[model samples]
Each structure stands twice: as structure tokens, then as C-alpha cells.
Target: MTFDAYDTWWWPYLFVLVAGWLASDIWRFIGVAIGGRLDEKSEGLVLARAVATALVAAVIGKLIVFPSGAVAETSLLVRIAAAAFGFGAYLASGKRVIAGIVVSEAILLTSMQLA
Candidate 1:
């Protein structure tokens, strides 16, 4: 028995899709069984939210301040300028997370275009 290119290359991608969905659905099922009760209002939930937010912010900060790969070639000043403007727009939009994400992405694309 021999394995072809798909067994070596594409099968990994297929496995990732299947495994990723299975892993993600575990959390979804847990949340569903929990059902948004006082559990949602618990200290643990609040802490989890804060920690997740902080982790995401830290990643974004690292990307802007010390990007790697091709983005590393972009000027630090440009990154700061884009982040500042994005943060401003985020604040102006009443601190909506989606707005902040969109603004940051828009700024990144604009910066990439300039680069």
C-alpha cells in the first residue's frame, strides 16, 4: 500500500478541518449546556473575559510594536501611527470591539498598501 500526494499533503488539511471543528464544538456544547445562567455572571466568567481581552490586546500590541516576517519591514512609526488612528476610531465608536477590529484591519491594509 502506498500514499499519494493527497495522503501526504491534502489529508493533513482535511484532518485539521475535522479536528478543528470537533475541538471548537466541544466548547460550544459546554456553553450550550451551561445556558447563560448566573454562570455567565460569575467571577470566573468575568476573569476569563478580561484575560481573553488582555491576551488579544497583548498580541495586537506585539504585532504593531515588533512585527515579524514581511510586516517587520514596515516602519515602526507607521505601525504606531496606524494603531493610534485605529484606537481613536475605536474609542469614537463607543469602544465597540467589532469597530476596533475593523479599524485595526483597515489600518493594517492601508499600511500594507503603502509599504
Candidate 2:
């Protein structure tokens, strides 16, 4: 039977439930079923890691170079300095993600306040 979401309030919920399952859950189930067979040191996995790292670096570069809202108001030198300090903190903290992010944000906010 065909469901019309516009005709009933409950139909929208049903539609979303079914559509969401088909859109995401199916892929998740497929991944779970097949993912176990993949080797940890496979070339594909290595490439995936490299691509993910590149994407993250690209995003960080974008944020530093083209910030928005209040961050955009800060000078380029301040942003670069903040990023440098954060990177240093990350290295100093044994490559901790939280340390890098917190130090970066603290530097940015403090610079903003001072400027």
C-alpha cells in the first residue's frame, strides 16, 4: 500500500522512519557484515587514512585562512599565531587532540579580547 504523508500526521513519521532506515541503516548493516574481512594494513585502509588526514588538514587550513563571524574579525597574524601555538601544544601534550583544540580556541579568544 502507498502511504501519503501529506494526508496524515502519522504518515510523515512512518515515511521518515522507513526512509531513514533505507538511507543509512542499510549501509551500516552492509558495512558491519563486510568490514570484518578487511585487513588493518591493507592499501585501501592506508589510502583512506591518508585521505581522511588530508581532509582534516584542509578543513583546518580553511578555518584559519577564511574564518567567519567573530573569528573573521581577528587579524590573519593572530589566527596563524594561534594555530602555531595550538600545534605546539598538541606536540607538547603528546599529540592530544583535546589539548590542541583547547589551546587553539583559548589563544584565539584571548587574542580577540586583547585586540
Candidate 3:
């Protein structure tokens, strides 16, 4: 009478699919529905964008300052240098996200090899 997800192989996959949809895709659908009515230059949208950008920056800062796993193996100087070069690449590449990521990853990989 009791359902045990672990008792069946397909149940775990079904649970994961349902959980993933609820966790992420549902938010996307909601955002699309509500965002469709908002003006591109609305104050609400601008504030939301600013908040999102700040959250990303804070996360990046945390990773650099209090790194864990493989990244923690590198010296603080290496991390900072990589971030600086990545920012410069971002700016020089007309603010392209891919440019920043590629430059930062390359710097980190090279530094890790050298260290």
C-alpha cells in the first residue's frame, strides 16, 4: 500500500523529471507569462536585472575568496589574476560572456599547470 520510489528504477527517473520541471521550468514559464506584459525599460525589470547581476558578482567573489575543491588548490594570487584578465577580456570583447569565461578558464588552467 506504500509507494517506495527506491523500489523501482523508473520511479527515480520520474521523480527527478518532475522535480526538475517544478524547480526550473515552471519558473521559466511563469517568467515568460508575466514578463510578456512588462515594458523593456520598466523600473521593475531594471531593478531585477541589477539584483541578478549583483548576485552573480557576489557568487564569483565568494568562489575566488573562499574557494573549495580543485580551485582551492590554487593560490589567491592566481585566482585574482585570472579574474582580472577575464574582466579585461570581457570589456575588450564588447562585454561578451563567452570571452570572459574562456579567458578566465584559460588563465586558471595555465596557472594550475605552472603551479
lDDT tens per residue, model 2, 1-115: 3666268778877877887667769968888988657687999889979998998999989999998887899999989998999999999999998998899899889988888
Clashes of each: 0, 0, 0
Q: Model 3: per-residue lDDT, tens digit, 83-111?
A: 99999999999999999989989999998
- For candidate 3, list the clashing residue pairs, or say none: none
Colliding pairs, model 2: none
Question: On residues 1-115, what C-alpha lDDT tens digit does candidate 1 reach at each position?
Answer: 2233364667766666667777779878897997866666899889989998998999989988999898787788877877787778889999877787787668777878976
- TM-score of each candidate structure, all chains considered together: 0.57, 0.66, 0.62
User: All models: lDDT?
Assistant: 0.79, 0.87, 0.87
Worst 10 residues of 2 by lDDT: 1-10
lDDT of 3 at 19: 71
Misplaced by over 4 Å in model 1 are 1-7, 10-19, 66-70, 93-115
TM-score of 1: 0.57
